[model samples]
Target: MERKRHHEEASSESDDENYVPYVPLKERRKNEILKVTKKLGRAGRLLQEEEKKESTDDGGMQDEEEEIQVGPNANMSLLDQHSELIKKAEAKKESAREKLLKEEERILESVAENKALMGVAELAKGIQYQDPIKTGWTPPRAILAMPKERHQRMRKKMEILVEGEDIPPLCITFKEMKFPHIILKALKKRGIEKPTPIQMQGIPVVLMGRDMIGIAFTGSGKTLVFALPIIMFCLEQEKRLPFVKNEGPYGLIVCPSRELAKQTTEIINFFSRHLVEDGYPALKCLMCIGGMAIKEQLDMIKQGVHIIVATPGRLMDMLEKKMVNLDICRYLCLDEADRMIDMGFEEDVRTIFSYFKGQRQTLLFSATMPKKIQNFARSALVKPVTVNVGRAGAASLNVTQEVEFVKNEARMVYLLECLQKTPPPVLIFAEKKQDVDAIHEYLLLKGVEAAATHGSKDQEERSWAVDQFRKGAKDVLVATDVASKGLDFPDIQHVINYDMPEDIENYVHRIGRTGRSANRGVATTFISKACDESTLLDLKYLLIEAKQKVPPFLAQLEAESEKYLEIGGEVGCSYCGGLGHRITDCPRLEAVQNKAAQNIGRKDYLASNAADW
Candidate 1:
């Protein structure tokens, strides 16, 4: 038992020597923090050494090493350093952004200053920027201060007279006319940048709400002169009162022929298209003439139309049928008024005029003003301004006139010769439709591509033929007065009068087809014994006024007619071919007068015989 006790004591002493004591929680936490601090110090020294090595190696090192050295205990300190680096970077980026913004502002201010300086410089140079279409804007006085030579030329070339309350100054360029931007753009697209002499004066007068009598030659841009102002006025009206159902047309354009009406409608619609595209209300222009489906026209009117271009006959038909109305028409234009009257449309025109009740603006445009036209104007117009571009009934100076004294039978041969000598696109004028057909057939047989247009041909065929001629599909066009006055053929090289018209004014219009818009052209007239003596004298003076060379035959005819006036020789009576009186004053009258005188004598003789019985 003593040996076992001694062994137990030795074992207990050994166990006590190996046993460890329990520590407090706070003391354990303190020791752990101290150990982490020491480890962080070591990690910092190692990181410095690695950074030095990386700098020497040009930063070619493993990124994993840096992450491994960062212990969980040191995470807070590393994060704080990262936040400080981010703050420094943000400050530098903000400074750069501010500098850039300041530079951009400076640039914008400099550009604005430069623009202001440029405007001031332009003003100092006596250049003013004027908006032509601005209300109350008058024409610049500088336009009247033209060069002396230019003024002299204008006076000699154009006979412009303005008689009204206040006439607007003449426009040199189309820009000076103060058209809308879209209209100006359209004009530019059409290459019509300059205004003709008549347009320069006539457009403004018409816009002033005054009646105007524009006496200008054909192809003188008269269409635009009246058309522009009418369009502008209609647009103004549209702005005031939007289009309504069955309001009737705002403008009425009367043409002598269906062809002219079609052309005028096309022009109006062309300008109206731009207005529509620019977000304005749709402005529709309809062509109301014969030879088309009236039902379609009526439907168009029902749908809504702003303008109507019509002939007197078709318009009368529509008016009689009550298909259309013109009661609310604000503008009335009579194009080719003389021709309208001469074609026996006077009564129809008067009938149509009676429908308009309220005050309306009227414009009369004619190439010539005769007694009848003057009378019509006096009755219709209200103190209209008479604007004449040149002398009335004067031929164009651009045409070279040639009068050939050919017999009636040789006229065709002479025309063929002229055609062969001249270029393509010759317009031949005849007195009758049969003559035109005959000439057209002959030209076809002669291997010349030709077409004919007259009243007998339907409107479609006539329009097709005109288009063919215009497109150069046909070279020659033979027609009567139907193609004379208002048809615009730009490439007509020659105008040949196969038969002289009875009216000298028709002759002027016939040749007026050529030499239009200041282009050079030729006019050949075939004069025969059938031509009257008075016509010959008129031709002589017309040729002289146009600065054309008068043939010796016309000169001799004029001299022979003047001899009767110079000497006291008896003038031949136009009625009986007797001497000493005019047609109205002729004493040797008709057979009825002689028979009445004989009856009176017989009554006296019977009375004497009764007394003797």
Candidate 2:
């Protein structure tokens, strides 16, 4: 039995050596195709059975039965092999197509990004930073400084008495008498003898310790209107009680911007310069605005300031920190009330109001008092004297309205043309920071002197830019709403609305930057057919309501705005432009790197990247 088993095993081993396993590639391919075919056949048979039961009422079911046959009698292995090869070829083709599509998308994005960078660089090349000269009319300084020659001319044109009528000693309250004679003398030297309309109307009321509301246009001397009375009253209190009272100032002047606060403080200083010079109880002024260290302001207060000029947010911060005490605050002056509201400072205003006592005298001033402002007035002032200077809507009347219809694509070209044609020391306003930057860049590239002022810029940068604008080194300032109010550019011959304002009140505030101090000024607004209802409303508000003439071209453009809206579609690119590109695109992509490098050579990226990196 062992011998037999051994022989069988040997035979099996020899048979295995002689035999080769056949792997028919074609048959295997065919079998795979057949397996798929069999699945399809089985599925078809099941479907036929279902239809035979369902279509007992349909003649189409009978026809389907005749066409369907269930059997393995037919073998088309060759056809199956061919079909399998075809399927493989089709899958390869699809894969290639998908890869090609992905590559194309990537290339298109790269090209678009490069193109955007080039465009930004081109715009940046146009900037001409004109060095500031002390002799020239800088935008704000031209207006604020009020050159001696122009001042003399204005005094001549207007019936301004260099030596104003003196108030009766009785009419001049004890508070008024307490003011350092130096401040009064400075007012006399500046040819500001009599209080202007705002001063005359608002001052006596404020001194009487009443809450008053003064609505007036820019450069109507609103600062002195509220300031003088507050100072006088505080000085009277100081003199009446002597050093027994530790409290310093009873007056608080709240401005909306750092520039406005600074400008207002300067004006106040000028008025009180005599006191400081004479050394008789110097009128100490403290300025509190954002971008400065709070500790510095606190330190100044610690040294005992006589008057407070502050922005809302920082003041509120100080109040919270116990760095300031408003318990003794007897007077409040809100300069540029409209601007404060427009800046979304309503809550801050309310918060500050809560800190002051109810007995304090409140004086509010603004160029335009819309319904919201009127409501604020109702809440703030108690049965206040509402003084409307000029007309409620006539703020822009002092500013001449000129409108230009330009295509969206040709905005830069037309902007350059306008700048070239405009007189020196023009102020240009854009709706958005991006537009401000763009316009600033375009102007620079075209050899036009320009700079921009917006919230994005640091405090020092903004101050420098405004100073340059004020010095006439930069002939034009491309700015946002940040420059709309609280800015006094005295010699601005023209205000160019490179982009129309979003709100009518903003329009009044913007163009009002010019036409200051009874100086005739022209305002040119670039309106595209695609501007929104708000833009149109602002134009109409200026024309019909404000009594400014509507340019013939703006009327035409307004009529055709529907088509423009369809083309531009919206205010900003919802995806790409709104937040610096859409979701699919990485926000971290390199910006127009060389744009800022050529002009400033500081390698500043487009500000949108500031958020990302």
Candidate 3:
């Protein structure tokens, strides 16, 4: 029994030597951390020694010893890579922060520049409210599914210039734009096989409920850009819930000229016709112009209108008279904005805006955006996308320009010769109304079929003359810049500038009468000593830029003006659209500045003499 107990005790002693005690998780973690801390300290010391050895003057023996020590800590090598990565990331972040600061400073500088020009600026750095229309928009599922690079390529191929963030995908085809079947049918009936560049970018953008400023070559189908989208917009509204009597006119198109209002109405009517034929709601479009019976337009308004196309004069008249209500109107378009602003219609536009009851999508379409338009857009438009199809003040490539140095006294005799350059169905533009009448008389006396129209003429006479010219009843039409602004005359193979226009922008529009719809045409301008040096210089630049032949007169003018063209030779004035002159000497800009100064002087004088009042 004694031997058995001794053996058992020895077994218990063996078990005690192998036994491990239970530990709480917290205590175990603390013990593990302490052990790791010790290991790290040892590793740190060893690493320091290794680095020191690497830098020491000692040779083979010490280098080998350092390598041996580093090899034992191979598992911890990721620490070096991890630290380097952290440094790189920190550097990238710092660079990004610097760039952001630079951009902010640039924005502030731009704001200061605007303050110098207009004396108006956003007062403080505040939260800019994003337009709900923009925030609310989402791309169609199919459009979203497209490869982003495809849209980039489309813009490149189409030569579409866009400046905005997150612009909508461009549509290559009308079908791709997702136009309604009926509207597509109307497009097919009109024989429009493809969408123009402006239409491609403008349609999706406007349809997405964003503001836009579109600049494209004349006759590049700008009207359709807004026209089609407006139709689609109204149709969607009507289909959701039919417009009650006098409750609609959900869209409005404002034009600078009565003729443009009439033409735009025709286009709207052309497309809206499909809606009714295919069992959709009747989309009524009214033409409100100066000559039209206001009572008749009012009566049509009473019957309920979905769209109204009007000129500034008549539209402003009705709005002020309470004959129209824009309570439901959410879309507004300014066609030929440059001419409209030139006619002093901008003030009227401001007045008309007072009548609008809510946020509206504003669109300004022009070949050239003037300084006033730029200021107005900055104040009014909320993140408007500027879609310029070509460069500023660019003319169509399809027009072959011919510049002739003809004396003023000899120009009349050369008129018949110029007309002979191209066939009938030609358009002639003169700088003055009297010049138009004189040219018309000369053409008739010469027994050439011709018609004449100008601003002073009644709308009926002008309409008849334009109708006669379009229907082939008259072979030629002679007019001032009035007829040249946004008038479409088919088969117009030739354009004659009997006198160079006072403004280069007008000259662009006058020549744009030809070279339309992919049809090549010719423009002949008669330059003489009567022309201003500014006009002549601008003409020289236009010819050279167009790659046309510059007569000796213009070449000499260019050489003489080389001093002025030394700076900003490649670009023209954005404020005036004059290629020959810089902004510092731009007559229009100078005149505006002087006028503003006078106004300010008058205000100061009034304030100083307040007691007199």
Candidate 4:
């Protein structure tokens, strides 16, 4: 009020009809002289007081009043000081009736734009995150008061670690997490009896409304960690304040792969059905991914939507077309976040971030978080709690890893014997689409029910293959690395890598397909001369870390890696998350950096643009 009153008073003089600029330079100079005289008078008095005090307190001082006020360009030794002072005196004074905060200050407060004019530009306006909610609903005192040592012991037992400031405690069970009755019932219906390591800690942190980075081995039920909470969140919001037409999607789940997006949407649909059954408001969740008709998705949003699970490309396209708006969207979860970056979706992800209307609760779930992804997380999410189950990029301990030296020609024959060792429902991962098709054909000729998925397969075919495998209709699913990231298949007895993956991270994800949901499984990897020594060395160290037996061929590499291993300790290669090699020797890191450079290089058409006449 005081500032406003002063501003109004000062502006009143200028608001008068007689207000005008000074006609002569002499008139402005007179006013500036008055102001400068007052300023210098005050400075001279203060300096005199200090000089007097010093002389009285100590010995007599000959020199006094040393400080002097001068114009910015008034250098003591320069001859132009007199002219600079004259120029300064003729300058215009700033307005006294200024805005409280400049444009830059408003942005710092998250007020990127001024309030819109009502009835003019207000239609479909977004909720500004001027004062975003930093913390979620308060948890029970017991959860908040858990002892640090008890938290540590629980995490150690589960082989999980939660690191951040003001981290919420983990829940022992689904009920302990204080989920709604609908959620509890849905969990029971899905047979999710207890929380996995990632779920235990991740659910609590996200439910508390904090941003999170969840890193667990693949097949550790990372889907439910975000799925259940998002269901509860959407349900609560609808019951409290329902969404109207064209006005929602309070929750979002982003997947790198379209198949994973479909899977997550299915889970949400199931829970949404449960919510409706319990007489809750209908929570609309949309799978806003590509390979589907955009018109149908637009139709769904016209009614209302509470959640969306989408891939980067499709989501970005929708945002660009103005078909979808993130005006009220919150609670974003990035599943297989590291894979998203690995697949070159970082820019799309950032572009998607620009559409967000307000600050939101973001969750990142991945099997591996290399340094590149870690840096992305730091920029995208708020202060986030990182809940890691087992080591990042570590192969699951539940899978018994077996590496064999099979010549290129002998792998096909050995694969038959390897399959015979395990029962039905085995997963085989090949690096190439052609290899996947060939393996599927060979398995079918042997009277084995099998399916294949790859980039060449359309969305429907890919989904059908996964469903057939999940339902036990097919005993085997041969796929490229597409299936290795975030697809959930239950009760697989064995996994075989038809050939070694190019990188160690892909190797971990391949075997991770089987040993999921606390089930013991086997992973057999066949390597020939085609496989390089670097990946083999990484595999050897990985097997040793998981306590798997080392083959005779890999024993030599193990001895070689021991010296580097001892130096690395628990801090392995922070760049690519490889165990045997440091960042200096990492192959994937070199490739990604080279690709990044290439992305910024000139296009072919631009090369011949010089003096084309």
TM per candidate comes to 0.67, 0.60, 0.76, 0.76
- What tens-digit string does per-residue lDDT give for candidate 4 at 62-100? 222222435654336565776666666654221211221
The list of candidate 4 runs beyond 4 A from truth reads 1-136, 558-562, 566-570, 596-613
- Writing each residue's lDDT as its tens digit, candidate 3 over 1-613 gives 9999999999999999999999976467557756765788977567656655675767657545544554544545688868877999989866864664455345334432342111112223232336726423345678779997988888888899888767888877788777778888888887788988989898888878888889888888989988988888887788888887778678889988777788889888988888789987778999999876688998899988989999888988888788889899888888887678677775677677667666778888987665445555655566778888876667788899988989998998998898888888888888788988988998899999999998899999988998888899999898888777777765888999988888899999889889988889999999888888887888888888888888888788753334445332336554577888755456666677688799999999999899688
Residues 426-519, model 2: lDDT tens digits: 8888888888888888888878888889989988889899999999889888888878876778789788888776555677778888887767
Better of 1 and 3 by TM-score: 3
Which whole-number lDDT from 0 to 100 does residue 450 have in model 4? 92
RMSD of 2: 22.7
The TM-score measured for candidate 1 stands at 0.67
Best by lDDT: 3
User: 348 in model 3: Cα distance from truth in Å?
Assistant: 1.1
Please state every model's RMSD to the true fold in angstroms.
Answer: 38.1, 22.7, 19.9, 22.8
lDDT of 3 at 443: 88
What is the Å distance of residue 494 in model 4 from its true position? 0.9
